[model samples]
Target: MSVHHSVSTHHHGGSGAGWLALFLVLSLLLLGLVVAIATAIGDYAIGLDTVFLAVTNGLGLTGADISPIEQSVVWDLRLSRALVAALSGAGLAICGAILQALLRNPLAEPFVLGVSAGASTGAVCVIVLGIGGGGLSLSMGAFTGAFSAFALVAILSNGATSGPNHTILAGVAAAQLFNALTSYIVTTSGNAQQARDVMFWLLGSFGGVRWPDFHLLIIVVVLGLGVCLYMARALDAFTFGDEDAAALGVPVARIRLVLFALTAMITATIVSMVGAIGFVGLVVPHAARYVVGPMHLRLLPASAAIGAVFMVLADIASRVIVSQQTVPIGVVTALVGVPFFALILYRSRPQT
Candidate 1:
């Protein structure tokens, strides 16, 4: 009996150590990727020293001397854009993951929910319609679009009566209608410059992300994740159908409202910051599920981290695609996303 007990303890100890080591390795691997991608970009590649130095220098501290131009490029330009891209991408991916589990549909995402499309419509209105320029107006417009989409979906679904799956269906209906509205605006604009400007913003770029917007994205991302963490138990309950969830003490109605609002706000923030960069939402969650399984507590953070890496790498590729001008990050994402989406559809097809 004594020998058996000792062997059992030894086996369990080894298992625990193995798991702990696995977690550490994965976390470090992801961090290393984020750092490496953050440092390496096109023609004007900065070393690890310059990346940290420029960022510190911005806060009235000195670290190293690269150049005035290089400092400006790394600190003001690249750092903010990279951070924004990472945060937005990660937040959106978490949103997507939540939605997938909530609605129990693999097809669910920002685009499918109509939040992204509605936000796109509002952004196009500002850029093409010339409401206002380059400041609060743009962010406000994008938020308006995002909220409008969520509101329309909610209202149409009769939120009091409809379930989460029902709500997703309502979103599909709303998205189709908003997409039509946006398309109409593009065709009706009739001015080449207006149309081109609208089109470009829709295609997305992190090139000129400003300090103000970057801060806002950070706040929103952090807040959204906070809400997500608090409600993770409800979300996990949501995984097992509504009836099962309710039996397990899940507040179905409240959790639905919280997640919907959180995701909409997050979607708006991302759209405002990066002009509707795609794929990160649809792909990241699926990848995270493979890594960490379906538990929201582990899944959300992992999805966010991996999603951040995904966008930064894509942004890097966008900048490197040409010698003179960088391609819009949106275009790179779309090209990649559409094919990946097709693969997903094919793989998930019912094996009838």
Candidate 2:
């Protein structure tokens, strides 16, 4: 009976692994399709074939048949934006999944930890005061701000002593303080144009993303995913509670501190590149959980894939939603996220 039970458990695990592999492949294909479509359907529409050719030529896999202008539009502009969108989305979603698992809270996300607000404050300082020096300065400032906020939260949370509640409270305090700082900077020091730019950034826009941003984002997202996956077992143990995790030989306090800091870094990197694009981290994990169940190993990859697809589609929508005017990516995410948030709330209520 013992042998039979072991065999059955192994068989079940194999089947689950197979299903997850299939789901991941399908999600990746969907993401590719979205990227292709996004590249082909902008204002100056490049055909799908042309986009492919441009990509191949850029890779030196084929000779260029497309015009220089079309090549530039496809390879230089749209592809960079799509890649950034996908990377940022994947990073944010993974952060959300980790935070939720770490905190054991369904509502936990990257922003709940005050990283975005801190980033915004840092960016505001750069833009309003001209501290950093150039375009890259804003990103540098935001990164600094994000880390600073996380540091404050860690200190106030007392290194996971009381519980996630303490961490959440610390995050809330940090967010409010940073947000006020951002507002004060914008109101007091920023010129009209700077204010307008800062507002657009606060709302999030992918319009200005370039290859440099894409390169940095891809590196960060890949590293973050690797770190999260390595800690997947710890995250799974956390689902049972801190006591259970400690019993399982996981250093509950240390692990929590590490995961929170890692997530904060990933969130800050993405926020610095694209501004504080909300809701991807908050909503994508829940959607992925519904599709893939609650195992962190499966949940993390599923969330990342879904998030990448969602953000690319959102970017396309932001571009085409209005004639000749781009909507902020944050606004697009909010419009989609609010309905999901409502649904989550509705479902969470006790059914009589």
Misplaced by over 4 Å in model 1 are 1-40, 59-61, 132-136, 350-352
Score candidate 2 by TM-score against the native: 0.95
| Per-model TM-score on C-alpha atoms | 0.87, 0.95
- Per-residue lDDT over 1-352 for candidate 1, one digit per residue giving the tens place of the 0 to 100 score: 4322432333334554465457646865875566456655657777776677777788778756678987887777777777787787788798899888788787778777889888888887787676665654776888898899999998988873577778888898888887888889889873887777667777788866877877888888888887897887677777767777777777787788778888998998888767877777888888777766666766787788878778887887788788768888888888888888888888888998
lDDT of model 2 at position 31: 92
Q: How well is each residue in 1-352 modelled by candidate 2, as lDDT tens digits?
A: 4322432343347777898899999999999899999999877988899999999998899997789999999889999999899998999999999988888888889999899999999998988888756765888999999999999898888867768777888999999999999999999998999999999999898888899998888888898899888998888888778887787788988888788888988999999988999889989999998987787888999999999999999999999999889999999999999999999889888989
Poorest stretch of ten by lDDT in candidate 2: 2-11
Q: lDDT of each model, Cα atoms only?
A: 0.77, 0.89
State the RMSD for candidate 2: 2.9
**What value does the lDDT take at residue 306 in candidate 2?**
94
Best by TM-score: 2
